[model samples]
Target: MERYVDGFVLPVPTEKIDAYREMAAEAGKLWIEHGALEYFEGVGDDMESDMDGMPVRTFPEIAESSDDESAVFAFIVFESREHRDEVNAKVMDDPAMDPERPSEEMPFESGRMAYGGFRSLVSYEK
Candidate 1:
């Protein structure tokens, strides 16, 4: 079945990777509990690439991050756009989300995050 995905690209300070992981783990649980099919978060490992000498903007460059920050790519999967909306509504209402929390307290710069929801154009699984 075609699925929906909410993706994010952001910069996280390398020094707070562990903290970010912890926070992401908790958030993932909330998402799953609220009905997300899957939740995944990954920090940049081998992001720097020249693309065989072709000019390309790297992940860090896209996220506008400094050397001390790592590019983080994350996503949540859902049955459909409606399903995603339902799950997100519940998750947002959950106190764990801290809807009113200060951005400065977050592990990464919330303002710099690039987020979007996408309907799957093609999908395959083993």
Candidate 2:
């Protein structure tokens, strides 16, 4: 079945990776509770050497990350485009997810974060 995905890439200070992970964990839980199919967050491990001859840009390059920062890639999957919108609306309305509410400050810069929604063109599972 085709799926929808909301993806994001950002730079987080290297020293704040653990803190970022903790925050992401809570965000992931809220997303799941709101009906997100799956939520995944990954910190760049082998970003530098992996793109030896590739012409495409790497996560760090795209994020303009500094030496002291790590590139973070995250995604949340949904059953479809409409489902994604529905879940996101509910998630945003939840007080716990509100940006205006008092909460631990983000470990990364929000202005530099890249975000997008995509419709899966190909999907496979065993």
Candidate 3:
């Protein structure tokens, strides 16, 4: 199967995780409603790594999260880049995604978030 994905990494205040989760859940529904194949929001549980001698950074280190913040890694799946674009366009147009939503209501700083689109290299399904 071929697939495209939009991924994100961000830091969310630990005290605001619940609020973040609530917002993310609603957004996930919107994505799905607009034709996303899958919408996933993951809050870090085991973000640290003992890579031993390997030279690599952990999610927390990469996101520059503080002791009072947690790293969030999320992704949305689509059948293709075009499909992703279509779904995202619809989602963007949805009233629930209105830009008027106050930034303060979000649990994380939008400027600090990282996002990207990727084409599938390998995909499998059971």
Candidate 4:
């Protein structure tokens, strides 16, 4: 039973890229120091795919499609849900968490920025 912190980020306007990048980098470092297992960032590009029929892929695919600048995604794995919750609480309460703020010039609506805590229902890896 592994716990993870998943985040979905949409970029700010072109003019704000530098500011956003700096913010995200600082945020990643803070999360790591606060107990995050891993942090990763990626940029989105245009692509064609049919996502209407697949609920699992719909959101991510659409996110990539519409993302002209970048979208940051991160995952932090914990030994158990309880531990995850504990670490998350500490992380949230830490003053360092404030540095990850999204810029005012964000291209997408703030409501669109999504985040969640997830437990591994099943996994296959080699």
Steric clashes per prediction:
0, 0, 0, 0
Judging by lDDT against the true structure, name the best candidate. Answer: 1
For model 2, give the RMSD to the true fold.
1.8
Error of 1 at 74 (Å): 0.3
| Model 4 local distance difference test score | 0.59
Q: Per-residue lDDT of 6-93 in model 1, one digit per residue for the tens?
A: 9999999999899899999999999999999999999998886858889988788889889899999999999999999999999989
lDDT of each: 0.93, 0.92, 0.92, 0.59
lDDT of 1 at 62: 84
TM-score of each: 0.94, 0.92, 0.95, 0.62
Candidate 4: residue 55 lDDT (0-100): 38
Clashing pairs in 4: none
- Range of the 10 consecutive residues with the lowest summed lDDT in candidate 3: 47-56
Q: Write the per-residue lDDT of candidate 3 for residues 24-83, one digit (tens) a residue.
A: 999999999999999999999986576887877888887889999999999999999999
What is the C-alpha lDDT profile of model 2 across 44-113, one tens digit per residue? 9988645667687889999899999999999999999999999999999998875774444778888899
Off by over 4 Å in 2: 49-52, 101-104
